[model samples]
Target: MTYIDQLGASAKQSAKVIATLSTATKNKILVAVAEELLKSEEEILTANAKDLELACSKGKKPAYVDRLALTSERIIAMAEGVREIATASDPIGIIDTGWLHPKGMEIIQKRVPLGVIGMIFESRPNVTIDAAALAIKAGNAIILRGGSDAIYSNTMLKNIFVRAGIAAGMPPASVQLVEQTERAHVRELISLNNYIDVIIPRGGKGLKSFIIEHATVPVIETGAGNCHLYVEKSADLEKAYAIILNAKTQRPATCNTIETLLLDYELLVAFLPIIAQKLADAGVVLAVDLTCMEILNKHKIIAEHATSADYKTEYQALKITIVAVGGVEDAINHINTYGSGHSEAILTEKMAASDLFAQEVDASSVYINASTRFTDGAEFGFGGEIGISTQKLHARGPMGLRALTTYKYIIRGNGQIR
Candidate 1:
């Protein structure tokens, strides 16, 4: 049989074992896994070095290799993330709702595991640990398909997890990795919807769009962030400038980085130039609307006239497009129209406007007077995450253990005539 066929069979059997395993058992496995990660950090780093060397030799960009590389600090971070997730309340079997019918029938809507999750992601090698920990803790088995760039590192990581699981008296097959990193293998795995309960593609737009288009399995499409931050009329100038700079420049390669800034007309005259100058000093390229361009040009802040295309762009760099909106409503409309529904924030002193913006903006997380960069699973108290879900279907926000589950109706009834 093909490797895909063998993987599908193992995953199907592992799901049954995991679904019946107690939470305590899962936590034990997590603790052992964490211990293993710490013990093997040097070996993991050695494996990561090979990937880094290959990436550098292939002339891959620095940013790409940086994401592909792992260090002892990052390995410890991943291990600590596992411990945090293990401490989280078990999401499985939680009764969401219950009701009793007039005919002496009791019904319970309880959360259950998704059985087997086929997770395909890129760049970040730490996802191997995070995804495996979350899935096992939530009583689900997983099959991981990490990017070819991180293949060696992830393979070693997955081996550690399996060894830890088996040593902790858990089924090692509860976590599996696709040994084959070919594109065709991923397509084959995605096609096995009957064995794999769900397909979660966590990467950039290209991979997400490809999976959504081709995969028959139900997909949790993740990450296409053109996030925005609007500085409203009543926004504090200092706060707006600080938040904008931090959101746009702090880890600009991330999906939560602010791609656009909306400046309200009332504050445009006073606040625009000040913020523009600060950003210029920090070496941020400004794509400014006509009003902002006029203000910046007068103040000797280097900027260019922003086009409509700028609003739709997700520049994963130290660049941001600035636009002057008529009011809060216009800003909201702009975000809803062009934003990628990932993370949106507004800095405003007006409580009512902040509330309205938070409610109206269609995003996984909306912030008031806070940076959009806070829209992360760790920030949301989930420890770590696989990715942020941009779609509104199954998972809508930072995908933690709860988001990895579906519910079933656990009904109990006595023998009685209807």
Candidate 2:
């Protein structure tokens, strides 16, 4: 058999064990994986150093390097993420409902793992451990395919996590990272629908698109966070300042960071002077629309008229597009047209306005007087996440253990056949 075939067969076998594992046993295994990540931090860092060196040699962008690098603190967080999952309630066998049929059959639908999940991610080594730990907790086997840029780090993490899970009595093949990093590997991996129940890609638009377009197996489209934050005419200015600043600058490199700011025309003058200075001080480039340019006409803030394309782009940097909307309803229409459906927020204190925004925004998560950053799985108390999903089918928002499983119907019949 070919290499992927062997791995697929092993994962398929391991899925049987994963599906039947007791919650307590699964928790112990997940905890063990966390401990292993902590114990192997030094080794993981050593492996990561190799990747960083290569990335630097290739002159990768600062943001790219930041995502690829690992620190002692980051490692602890990765391990803690696993422990958090261990603490969550097991979702397996929770009956959706039970019904009796006219033909004397009783049927119940219950949660179960989605068999084998194939994760194709970019250069975030931490995902290596996070994905595996979550798979164990959710009772699903995982096949990992990380980018070539993070080969060393992913390889090291996969080894540590899988070894720990195996030692804790989990199936040996429960977590498998692709041994090769060639582009061809991903092409092969995503085509294996018979073995891979789902293909989840976690990265930029390019990576997410590649998998969604090419994968023969089921694919989950994750967050591309062209997220927006709107300031209604009646918004609390102080609250808007805090929420907008946090959402845009707290971590601009993250998928949840706000990329566009929709302002009510009535609030434009009042918000421009303050929000402009804050964003400029934070080194953010304001890609303004015509109305905003006129509003900030004399404010010597770092500003430029926003290009039409800026509204649709996911600027993974300290930059934002500012556009003026006629009102709250117009704001909703603008967002629904341009938003990526990842996360959106409104910094309004008006209960009516907040209700309108929350109800009308077409996003995975909508917020009132809050930052879009809370769209994260960990922030939502899901321990960690496979990724923030943007699609409607299956799951949306931050995907935790519960999102990793599908349901099965168990029917008990008394010799009845139609």
Candidate 3:
């Protein structure tokens, strides 16, 4: 058999052992993994250096480089994230609901892990530990297929995570990574329906599309964040400015970063110039609509005219598009048309406006008077996230431990017939 097949088979076997592992055992193994990550900081940084150097040689954008580069602080943070996730209560075996049937039967809907997740992601090496810790904590095995750009970083991180788990009495194949950084390996892994229970793609639109189209296994779509933030006329401009700036420039390369800004026309003439100045100071390029350009020009603020393409782009960098919208309704319509159904926010004090925007916008996560960046799983108190699922199938929004599971019904009866 081929290596991919072997990996799948081994993971399938290991998932069974993991699903039955006690919560205490899983937590112990995860804590060990966290400790191992901390211990291997130098080794991981060394390996990550290779990827970072390669990225620089290739002339990747600064934001892209940030995603690839690992600092001592980032390593410490990744370890902390792992430990925090380990502390989360186990998601498995929890009864969703229990009831008595009409025929003297007891019924239970219990949560269980989906065996062997096949995860495809890019750039961020921190996802390596995050994915492994989350998968194991939720009692599922995983097959990670990271981008070729991050191959060196991913390999070393995986080694630390998997070995620690196995040493701590976890399943043999609790976590595995595709060492080969080829598209062919991804193709093969996605088709292994018998082994991988669910496939989650966390990258660009093209990568997610490729996996979605080719995968025979069930797919959970994520990323491609053409996220948006709207400023209502009644918004507190100070609060709005802070939220927009933080959402756009805090970590501009992230999926939760705002790529589009919609403003109530009244706010457009006043708040847009102030917002644009801050973004410009941060070296952000503004692609503005005619109405926005007119107001910006009035305020002597320079901006490029927005192209149609800019509206739909997930500018995973220090760039954002600006548009003057009629009101909350106009903003909602625009978002539904161009948004990636990831995260969207409305900065407004009016409860009516916030509620309307939240209700009408078709996104996995919606916010009022806050940054779209808070859509993150950790921010939502999920510990760590698999991804912000953009699809409306088995899961949506921040995929925490519960999202990694499927439910099974157990009916207790004395040899009950159908």
| Top candidate when judged by lDDT against the true structure | 3
Candidate 1 residue-wise lDDT, 1-418, digit = tens: 6798789889999899999989999999999999999999888999999889888989987567767889888998999999998899899989999999888799899999999999999978899999999999988889999999888999999999999988997785889999787799988888897799999998877888889899988888888889999988888887777899999888888899999989888887788888888887888899998888888777888997888899998887878999999888999999999999999998989999998998899999999999988888888998678789999998888998889889999778888665
The candidates, ranked best first by TM-score, are 3, 2, 1
What is the TM-score of candidate 2? 0.97
Residue 354 displacement in candidate 1 (angstroms): 1.3
Model 2 clashing residue pairs (backbone): 288-306
Give the lDDT of residue 258 in candidate 2: 95
Which should have the higher TM-score, number 1 or number 3? 3
Global fold similarity of model 1 (TM-score): 0.97
Q: Give the TM-score of candidate 3.
A: 0.98
lDDT per model, in order? Answer: 0.89, 0.89, 0.91
lDDT of 2: 0.89
Residues 1-418, model 2: lDDT tens digits? 7788788889999999889999999988888888888888789999999999999999998889999999999999998888899998888889989999999899999999999999988988999888888888888999998889999999999889878888888998999989786788888888997788999999888888888788899999987889999888878888788889999998888999999999888877777878988898989998999878876777766588898799999998999999988888998998999999999988777899888888988999998888988988888988889999999999999999899999999999989999
Question: In the order shown, what is each candidate's alpha-carbon RMSD?
Answer: 1.4, 1.3, 1.1
Clashes of 3: 0
lDDT of candidate 2 at residue 34, scale 0 to 100: 85
The all-Cα superposition gives candidate 1 an RMSD in Å to the true structure of 1.4
Model 1 segments beyond 4 Å from truth?
none
